[model samples]
Target: MKRVQDWLLRFRWQKLLLVWGVFLLIAAVLFAERSGVQYTHTRFRLSYLPQEQAISKAQALQEQPATCLLLCDTRQSGVDNARELFTQLLQDMKVAADVVDLAEVSVNDLPAPENYQTAVVLMPNVEPLGEELLRLMNWVEDGGGLLFGMSPSNDRYFTVVSAKLGVLSTSGEYKQAESIVPAEGFMLGGGQRYELSDPFDSSLAVALREDTEVYAATGDEKVPLIWGRRQGRGRIVVDNIGIYDKVMRGFYAASYSLLQDAVAYPVINSAVFYLDDFPSPVPGGDGTYIRRDYGLSISDFYSQVWWPDLTQLAERYGIHYTGVMIENYEDDTLSAPERQTDTEQFRYFGGLLLRQGGEIGYHGYNHQPLCLPDTDYGDAYAYNQWPNADAITAAMDELIAFQKAVLPYAVGSVYVPPSNILSAAGREILGTRVPGIRTIASTYFEDGSGLPYVQEFDVAPDGIVEQPRIVSGGMVGDSYMRLAAVSELNMHYVSTHFMHPDDLLDEDRGAAEGWEVYKGGLVDYLNWLEKAAPHLRKQTGTECSGAVERFAALTVTTTGTNDAWELTLGNFHDEAWLLFRANDGVPGTVTGGQLTLLTGNLYLLKAEQPTVQILRQEG
Candidate 1:
């Protein structure tokens, strides 16, 4: 027994030593990896996409060569380094772009011949005079694009710029050379090796820290990373930190391309100037045609109007009708059972509609605008106005709860504001606060932008939604209702609405001739849509909003080292069926619907109808 005990003790010591030795080995390996001890230079792998792809994409929309003036107030080595980097990037773009160092350019020659499209002012530690800066602001607002880079220490300068540009500045110092991912249709190059680290100390990683208040006119309170506000006819892009440092250090691998894209986005978006009625032969797929379904909103049982003729007509026309049930309405108040009756009626009517392939969306808690005060005739203006965030939030909570109660399983991700009076702040609060609530409609009606007429506005930058507008009243005469049908067709989803048949009948009885024209226009539009449905890619409103959000989260950039280039792809599409065409014009197969790289020159092909191929030669 004594001898066995001795051996066991000996074994335990040996095991401890072995375990410690293994731990040490792992730590050593980790340290070596972190230190890049065993790292070696690798050959760069270029994509197979032909250079022609670039030319093709640029051919039709060729941008004129623009000169950029870089104004530097600092004589530091960092500024010199940044200038060199800018020079190199300009060469890489292969365009006739020039960057003039302001220090070298005589100040007496302040205004270059109006040909210089952009002026980048770099203020390291000094703040320019407010009046001089105002003049520069005026220049940019008039037409010239301006880029401003500031350091954390230059708070006064930052404040001046932010005040003028309607942006916020972070107080904390930024790390040099941070890698930023692009959002959409942008690509990044250079393998991990070429990835940017803090330029000050190549060993340190680049990072942008935010701990500052965003400055906007007192009433406009939205936080934006990069805010573009129309200053006169042109625009200004404001960066809180020293962009020159990032660009020079390779932190911004695709800064050059991104700058170009930024300048072009507004232009392209503006080119779509006119709003026309929805297009025919809708851009994408097909579906069956059923009679228009009117959503009869019933706040309570007593308010329910059961017209046998209407039900019969629905059946005859094979209409898959939907209905919204709110808790209460302006005139009719119901008892508990009556309210329950509303839900029960909805279930029965909903099931009937479902049998005919219809759907249902939530209305509101009391058949009124969620946050607006209640009035006698469902008029928001007459009700107590919603003036703050608390009221809006409470109203939203009530609406959501009511929705969950009435149709627990039947409800999908859709909400129709009672009068489209929802505020931008209210919508943002709801979207950010609620889960599973996908889409919300708003009241803005002007088609100032030629986009779809959907009432919702994306409070968050990059958010988008389908705007549903009332098109017609009846199916009899020449009231041609038009929408941006082609744009909506390309979208993954759509949302539209109609009231009850009684509402239509009332309108018709009051003004038969006008109603007839409205109805005829409605019928014509529906028929046209049905014929064109085959090309439309239909998705629910929730799906569409989610898609836009996901696309917004993506990062796109380009980076290149001496030997090779690498492009880092971001979540541009929730599920994009990407098409890659080789230099030879042959479509190559994509893996899991994603194309990582083209061994030779390759052009990216556009997809239509989720499956159809639309090819364009590379720029």
Candidate 2:
């Protein structure tokens, strides 16, 4: 790196020339492709859908028997998990309903009575005015359910809303640690703090009404965190604990799940397990433990020390892991002898993984940014802020070539960008240059100057799907538990988590300590998932990506209202659920899979095939 840096310093113009040269090459490729009438950039999101009609966003949000109305000042806030996820959770659970907010809605332009199944008044900055309250009351009286929530403040409208629900609110922070037990039917988990909320407690309290049923209770007293009652023509549920937890800082406590129950949204519980940075890069030294240690190669550790233990767990738990394979870094190619050893040992090890039901994914050719190297991993984002597309394509080409020769057979479509950062230009280059890679394994929140945040996931704007690995575990059991909780928000939602194999070996002490952490921490996590969420669907990165891609390419819509609808799916899995917000209170059924409750306003149809139907039961 020093030699290369010095060379670049001495010949600075070469960098400019290199960029220009790559640009020219890209132009030439584009021109040739244009002549043949096969332009790549135009193929962007178009290629993902070989045959399909788009479901208009307007149609999906049209009037329905069920509805979720979140009242908040949109201009005053950013992304709140409660506000954003509440709707997404509904979508995943498939309860057919429309979610309306002030930004795209006006109280004057509210949906018809047939659409008002549930009215959720979220934590607004201020108590709703008299006129708004009157409207909400009338909606409830007209049969609209209400998930009434307000942020922490003893001096706020607690008195007014509590009076309306016939409950009582008090001012006391939730400092005590305790388990919450929800009533038998609530799908929102009755679990521990979602890791993000510990150390600090919530500041909200509520005393239940005598006529109300408690859904979730907190502390030794089992005080109501959420409680509901039937009033006039509708039901109203309130969880002061939830409003405090979410409004304060998105702490995602069980209070949040309890709130979902309060809203009565049907939920699909799920979990996903996978590995990251599997084929670790050999950091710059030949005599290192990774290259050859104590007369054994790193591959020997993976196969003998690593594989045996993980394989036993996989077999025991029926889990399939996707190993993110890293090829090179900053021109850090292996010596001829080392490459030969790697080729042979990897073939054997990868074959073993494949036979044991594991798969491999591309992490990157070089574990550093594609733009350039600075002897520092942190500097990658700066260099790749706007990396050259053609150079990235060249690197991707080399990676595919190497994978063909070295890794085992399942050359899947998942790619985990190095440092978890890939410029949008770099991402699109992967889609255009390597059409075989249908998905990119990346952080839930992509950070790049090139890709817009909206197009980062849910099948990125580039036509490639992004199967997000929600959380990271570095050999910690409790951490894994927290991450697992974070991943299992809804059953129909994709669950994904990753761990580094190097976590198996202590950095300073090497394999001895890491393997212990891996066994004790991660294995416990798998078991916990089995016990906590037994129905978790296990799949390789390839499979997960394919599921997401198919779903993204699909267009599910409705019109003829016999409580039935038709959908045109893409390359979906053997069993998958397509969720939608429903109008009626009663649950429905389906043929391909099953009709399950997601939320009060949502329903999920699980099935297999490019076409499926959902028939709402007649009252």
Q: Tens-digit lDDT track for model 1 on 285-366?
A: 1111111122332222112333333345345433334344344443222212122333443444444433333334455544
lDDT of 1 at 406: 45
Write candidate 2's Cα lDDT for 1-619 as tens digits: 9998888779959779788999999998755432322211111111233313222222332443354455544543432545665555444333344555655666667655445455556554334333576667677776666765533345455565666675654655453324344444443333443333352344255565578766555545565656667667666666545433321221222223232222222222334466665554533323244343445565466656666777887888887777776664444423221222344434554555565566777776666444422223354333332234555666666666676666525565677766566554566567678876777777654344443222222555445666666555634355434544433443334456777665434454234444555467666666655654454467777666545544543334332245665554433434445544443334455545565564344444565665666565677
- The per-candidate count of clashes, in order, stands at 56, 34
User: Residue 226, candidate 2: how far off, in angstroms?
Assistant: 3.4
Residue 155, model 1: lDDT of 49
What CA root-mean-square deviation does each model show from the true structure? 26.6, 15.4
Top lDDT prediction, candidate number:
2
Tell me how candidate 2 scores on lDDT: 0.51
Quote the positional error of residue 590 for candidate 1 in Å: 7.3
Q: Relative to the unseen true structure, what is the Cα RMSD of model 1? A: 26.6
